[model samples]
Target: MSTFGQYFRVTTFGESHCKAVGCIVDGCPPGLELTEGDVQPQLTRRRPGQSNLTTPRNEKDQVVIQSGTEFGVTLGTPIGLFVANQDQRPHDYSETDFYPRPSHADWTYLQKYGVKASSGGGRSSARETIGRVAAGAIAEKYLRLVYGVEIVAFVSSVGCVEMPFIAQMRNDRALEPEFFQLLDSITRERVDADMVRCPDKDVADQMRDEILKNKEACDSVGGTVTCVIRRVPSGLGEPCFDKLEAKLAHAMLSIPATKGFEIGSGFAGTAMHGSVHNDPFVNSTVDPQGKPNLRTATNFSGGIQGGISNGEHVYFRVAFKPPATISQAQTTAQYNGQGGILAARGRHDPCVVPRAVPIVESMAALVVMDAVLAQNSRSKSASLLPAVSKSNPLMYGQPPSS
Candidate 1:
């Protein structure tokens, strides 16, 4: 299933170390404004070697638009986008081609495909996410313009370093642009500042010092990313299948090295009773001049009820496993099925949480965009159904004249 979506479809192609990786998006509405600039910022955020917290693989990751747009506007056709790979070091991987890295996809890929690309985990590499991020950028633009929906994600936890809860941050007024700027400035002062993207100055400093120590020892750690969505309209998902949360979890888990996912009140909800867990409704208002609004007094349901959006903030967290390519020596087997031990080499991250923030946000955008398109189709279908039924008559108890 390289293809995804029932309405706005996206088909990804190419491999991690192939000539290039790219995507073709079908079903994009025509006349939408788009350009390379729109997608570049996101790709830059996910590109490796940006700082000390990720693999030292430096890729320019410049995007090329091949088709489906003209004069900076979409043409209602399949949009083709690509990114060429530069700075590939096939030699770095030649030695380990025979010995699969522990906790990586090497063994599973071989069992399924008989043969696999020997360099850089081939299709299994996080490099494949370039295409996804590019496609997701376009989807995000559409979502914002049509729905005023906004998605923001950040590294909330790295191993033991956790950012304060949103409530606490808000209460502290830490979200002020100037306050956040000062926090960002302080982080930039450290050599390994990006090891964890936590906004707390003190916690970030501690995280950086710890990461540097681990880097010196050639070890790695894993952590989680929290994504928040605001102003999402109601009725955004299909029932029985393709629930909003289900689609989000599926997209997120597809990312390389992602091991777990939870939507709003996940896992922790087990501690509460039914009454405490439920999102109780309350009388609310939408527009000042319009009718009263609907809302939940508590968001235990995470802005979603019965697999459909209930007009609350939709948020979730995704957990990533430690990068398998640690410098520490480990037990493994040779390609010839001979058992042996090997130490992995190459430029790898001590922690991936900082870099993973953008990837999580991209996947979240992809899921939300698909759900929005599905909702649009359903609305159009319902609008026409009544007229069609009245005209055909056979659609109801009335039959055509004999």
Candidate 2:
């Protein structure tokens, strides 16, 4: 269960306070240009101590490519990646020895594993997501070079503050081309312009203020991350099971602190009648390659219909809860279920939404890359079928009579 994806198998190792944290990415197509430089950008974005809104754990998180490549080109083998932990203060989390933090994984981990790491939350810590972000960077590069696919995620909401564009789009019940155009135009540069990562300056300022206020009160906050995947082909998912949206949900909920997952209209669609919810298909103009495409007048289906992609932009949102470990005193239980007062004393994020943007995009890329490989294999297998008809008889010279 630690590994993710069918075609792109990513196995992560190490823990929060361990000597290192890294991942192994297998099944990548050979001859692709890859290096530590290609994998470091996302790692930097996911690293802590970058801003005041996150924890003050100063870690360089420098990634080293241990194997599976030479001359900066992939060899179609498992690529090993590692990043050493520089600022692991195990003593900061020693309090867990006495009491389990409220709503934290401390108790559940001990119950499931019988023994848990005394420092940090071990595999349950958000630090473990470094592997996903690193491997996802590789998957994203392949998707971009081969399929022209693009994935972007931003802080859609922080606590009660919501981005204006998202709120307006939801209120108007319309997804205009201009809106998608804006969504497509967004770059990591713009999203990272501020510490809050909202891409909307006014709202980002407010979100930052909210986080600061929470930090002032020795508390924390949570919000949502909205991701958009563009230029994905129409037929990249299975039908009966392993639906695209279902896979997306599985990947998202697996992220630490993720509480909810929604695609397209999500929970809001239940309010509208089927007539309004259904996307009316329309003919799409030919692309530069002179290939015909399909378009939908409405995208309530979120670019996927019948559990597969329809060549429209795939968009979704993830809900994250506040950091459970807070400086404020909390009345929680101990390992023996004894109640006591506890005040968590360690570096923690005042708000996680600002840092979750890259994580959401990375997870989305893994899902899409895996689905594309499956679809490609299925198409090749289908193409291998010989021309079969009465003219092409099997076994004997006579065709089977029906």
Candidate 3:
């Protein structure tokens, strides 16, 4: 289903090359402050032509809020958001619909629906994600305010290039924004100094040389993104039906061109014994002033236990395949019910890892916000008896006077 989440449902619509693409967010709580300005920055981050490393398709991706709010606060109604398609090259894709672009949804969409949008891979295009990013930005703001949750994602690999471990790169004394700025600067320098988004200076140079060579030949490549989430609370997921990691995986896989998803110690956990993979809990103090707390000595389970959050950091990785539209000529069929071959002609990213970083962060925010709302609902239900008892002053910390 296009819609996701039981408590915070979001449905995205529209297509590439269409007049506009957008999303409708249902179940957002009333009184939350929201505006078009809050969602615009994230959209701009994912818009095409932001950098030379991405597709040349230029779209301003200006967002417009249509409904579900009065003044600037949400009204417990469906939130509608739209981003117009400013620059489109429909003629370039006029013939692509009938023949199907290689490694794209053209064939699968046809097999499923018998018809497809004739321009720019239609619904399958990355353009559709504009709505997702916009909605995610709102979700992210809510999550941060309610739960103090923060998510950071970046290009960990492009071709053979990879960044350093996040822990090593962090500064112990710096604040959040400062730390992020440091990281962003380092990352940008590494990417700008070379074509690859890798943080390793030497490896980035090598990756750039290789990508430039391939670009010259009109081919493309793919890479992976690593996301780290901090300060996620405990007990934030339904056990079997709607596990947090499962929900996150579904969201990530739904993004266009995503091929794989893995949480902490994912497939590699198979290589370890149960004893090694387990996270052993220890009695601990919550803080300098708080009561005793539960803590895990290891995070082999990736901050999740029993399909629910364990109040630890959540870490994951997503893998994307090379852009399907390669300059190399390949054999295929034509719209006239005839067989032939065609070389893809268009401006496309040789590697998508750089652009995918923000997309991954956006999807993560949506999942976290949904989980937070579910947890709040459960907390209120479980505390009804306690709340009633507290209201009766006579019963406060006392046995029944029978």
Please report the candidate that would top TM-score against the real structure.
Answer: 2
User: Which scores greater on lDDT, model 2 or model 3?
Assistant: 2
C-alpha lDDT of residue 6 in model 1 = 64
Candidate 3 C-alpha lDDT tens digits along 310-390? 887787889998889887888887767688887776667777777777688889988988998888988888877544434
Models, CA RMSD each:
6.9, 4.5, 6.1
Model 2 has a clash total of 0
Model 2 residue runs over 4 Å out of place are 165-178, 284-292, 387-402
lDDT of 1 by residue, 1-402 (tens): 677676778888877667888789898889999999999888887788987767888888999889999999999999999999887777777767779888888888888989888787888888888888888889889988988877776666666666665334335422334423332233212312444666566767776766667777888877777777777889888887888988888899988888998776677666566876787779866566343468886675667888999988887878888778888878777878798887776667788777777777777888888888788888888977645534565644356887
lDDT of 2 by residue, 336-365 (tens): 778888988989998898889889999999
Candidate 1 minimal-lDDT segment of 10 residues: 183-192
lDDT of each: 0.77, 0.88, 0.76
